[model samples]
Target: MGSNPTLSVFLNHMFQENSYEKIIQTAILTAYPRIFTDIPLSKEIFDELERIRKTESHGEITAELKVSKLAPELEARYKLVDQLLHKNNATQILEIAAGLSPRGVEWTKNPAIEYVEVELSEMARDKNKIFKALIETPPNLQLKEGNALNLKDLQKSITHFKKDRPIAVVNEGLLRYLNFDEKAIVAENVRALLKIFGGVWITPDITLQKLLQVQNKTTMPGKNQEIIQRTGRNIEKNSFKNEEEAEKFFNNLGFTVERHSLLEVIDKLTSSKKLNISQKEVKKMLEPAVVFVMKLEDSRA
Candidate 1:
């Protein structure tokens, strides 16, 4: 073989295959959540991601922050995480497409935080092995494998731990791979879970098509970076179009959508920063990508 190609170029090749999406997602499962290590679990989650992406298939590393995906923006995921977690009084988080990153498990300083991570069957195996080496107490944390749409699979996994508690659900980089039916099915399950258990923290992002049009893309590593470069994996994206549509989509599904963006959340989380954008500025940029914190409409003091 000739000299090893740069990792970025290799990733571009691997994603050209049929299972490129899975491979890319698995890579993201490994990366994509470390921007918030200010929270303790964020560091643990970051470490877990580092371990999982070490696979030869995910991609090669030419540069330090070589992975790529959505937002294509700065690492402000913590602000997103913090707002959702705090608003719901979230104690349990069921993270779907949770390859190996442990943000849900690692970011919580709230002693009550418990995370149930769900990944596909193959990634689950690697995730479990990595998870075992990373934690001693398994009470606040659990990782299981299954299709996101299968409640039976979720049920089996849920049986292993506390069955009765309000659980917040996390979905990151999941909507792109799911069709409308799949999305609806998962939403139904989330509704079922929250209705039974107590909470749902969902971020259904704009489609891949719409995301690409944005100017301030996060050059951050998403699972698909390698695949996109190699296999010509063009992600299909849909525009959120506008806040009205975005808000209506989730609202119909039973969540109260507080439409904000990464910057808004960052402003809220970081009190003192000259680099911070003003409220009007963040609100303006939010036209393309905004954050929504949803909770049960009926809940009241």
Candidate 2:
């Protein structure tokens, strides 16, 4: 998406390497009720993924393998992002690295809000195909290809927004893959955008190292290990050392951080009932996850 050949090549390489993560996430969403049926082509995508996995893996891992509390955690994260978006009264929303998430489809149904879902080139193309095939594409929903590490790539999506209104920037599962330097670059890019169209950056992806270690060990040991091998990124290495360090990291980057516990949206998750996850289990699963709603420290908007 950039003129610089080296940068473009690097971005493409990153996308290609992590492409399977989207499929796994889509499969998780599709397996659960109230998620796949609500999103138009999610089930189809999951089925296709299953076909590919079966053919490629030779029955090593099937789509039916449950990844412990992953389904519920994802559900809670998705709902919590929406909750924080509404709470901040953000009508113009930009979701970075938005991979096959049905949030855009569902939110765009209300014409009052303008939603832009940005992803790397390949995933964006796939999402475009799904949208066009499933429904009459909503004018409010704009899908673009961009990289979070590059400000110019991110700025390209601004054309779809109303200039007079504040914009809320949201991302779910992006930051965990980045090391500290990459994260700072992303923070700077987002900070620059916030200065232009002032609004909150809502994300639940700011994970702590300890929390990630716990999840990896207990939640879905084998599955998480497989994902780690597939993606080739040490998630724990990319995570903050602790909650205080996470807050300090963002705060030092010119954003005032507000933490919203995932537990706040626990009761709203339908996956708990569908997956038969007890309240105790759900609470334990979600206890460490927090959605950070951040705004530029100096902004008066």
Model 1: CA > 4 A from native: 1-26, 29-74, 107-111, 160-164, 204-211, 215-234, 267-287, 296-301
In candidate 1 the C-alpha lDDT for residue 272 amounts to 22
lDDT of 1 by residue, 190-287 (tens): 76776667665656354433344443343232434444444343343323445676566656666666655666554443322323435454333333
Q: What tens-digit string does per-residue lDDT give for candidate 2 at 51-169? A: 55467563533443545357677777888898888899989999998876778877888999899987777668756766665667788889998877778888988776777799999
Worst 10 residues of 1 by lDDT: 66-75
TM-score of 1: 0.67
Worst 10 residues of 2 by lDDT: 1-10
Pairs in steric clash, model 2: none
Estimate the lDDT of model 2: 0.73
lDDT of 2 at 137: 78
